[model samples]
Target: MRELTHVDENGVKMVEVGHKGEVFRKAIAKGRIHLRPETIELIRAGKTKKGNVIAAAQIAGILAVKKTPELIPLCHPILLTGVDLTFEFGEDYIEATCEVRAVYKTGVEMEALTGVSVALLTIWDMVKAVEKDESGQYPVTRIENIHVVEKVKAQVQ
Candidate 1:
């Protein structure tokens, strides 16, 4: 096992990447939000009260990628070259995939993961009215499987 980079004798500290060479970094993350079939139909039909669910979620994902540093402590602010968010619908769920690309000294996996999380949350928020049960609880609605699916770092040429 490797030592934790965020900690040292001085206690927790941000990992310094200034000495590292810049590289082309990319990360892809995915997550899913489970909802009622009726809720999925509403989203598919563009009848959600909060406007377009997929559109709002896509924008939210991109914004989340840009704001990852502010949301996650100890994360370094990075200039992103690209961000992409996509959605695939199942019978009772929506799967979100977020991809982030940058040329920097460190990885962008956190940003990609953050993007997918927020996107899933946005979808849930947009459709919560239909997903809630009579007791005003989300009986079957849930978010899960948030993870970084891929990461690549190549030397900048």
Candidate 2:
């Protein structure tokens, strides 16, 4: 069995292995990604022609978070306590951050990541129509910095 690290009586490092699983617990996770320039411009200009870019993306993110289990196999279905999604526009790219909280036996990190990815894809779908010019050129190029920010386990007395 693999050994796991834990703090000892004097706050010293200790190795333990084969710990038993606990029932009914909760966990948290986070993620983010960068957006391309043409994608940003399409969002800013409201030229999607389908609808408001940000609004649609936000809605898609929320929906994705809720339906994460359905989309991804091996992920447990969880009742999310809360989900917050935000977009930060930068000079060269856009930052998408998704935070999800749930009171289940497993963490919601995958859900949060899925939400961000869907949001970005939604943006791409909406803008791809307008991004293609006469020469089939597009400005948006990449997405980066997708990761978790923090995670915590609640203790019961």
Candidate 3:
């Protein structure tokens, strides 16, 4: 069995903590989530009726990076050196990539992940009017493939 770290008062496992040193000082996470076919079409046609989905999502992603500390507990509030969010339009999906850079002791993987999640949420929100099915269900909402792509420790001269 894998070692567990978080324990309750009764010594029951509540969470699992991995190796301490294994955590990267600087890390990058790349994620690719899909949007529904109808939503994609609406985005391509610029006919969401709410606003520009890509632009709104892009802005939301950037803002999410800046507010990562507030959203995630235990995340150090570091000044991000850079944040880049790009959306690749596909026939049946949308690929979102968020790159976040910070010169801090802890990595910014959470920030990048949060950025992508918020961006996708924003897109869903903006296009809900068109994406909703006859029964008012959001059948096309989904998120997938969040992984680290790069990590580099800051140099101390």
Highest lDDT, which number? 1
| Worst lDDT 10-window in candidate 2 | 22-31
After superposing candidate 3, which stretches have Cα over 4 Å from the reference? Answer: 1-27, 154-157
Model 2 per-residue lDDT tens digits across residues 59-132 = 99889988987887656677778888788786656667787876556667788788888887777677666556
* lDDT, residue 146, model 3: 72
What TM-score, over all chains together, does every model reach? Answer: 0.98, 0.70, 0.77
Model 3 lDDT tens row, 1-157:
8654444566754233233232234555655556677778879999878888889999999999899879976566877888888888887677788888766556788888888888888877887776667999867666678776776765644
**CA displacement after TM-score superposition, residue 61 of candidate 1 (Å):** 1.0
Clashing pairs for predicted structure model 2, backbone only: none
The lDDT values for all models are 0.95, 0.67, 0.75
**Candidate 2 at 35: error in angstroms?**
5.8
For residue 96, give model 3's deviation from the true position in Å: 0.6
Order by TM-score, highest first: 1, 3, 2
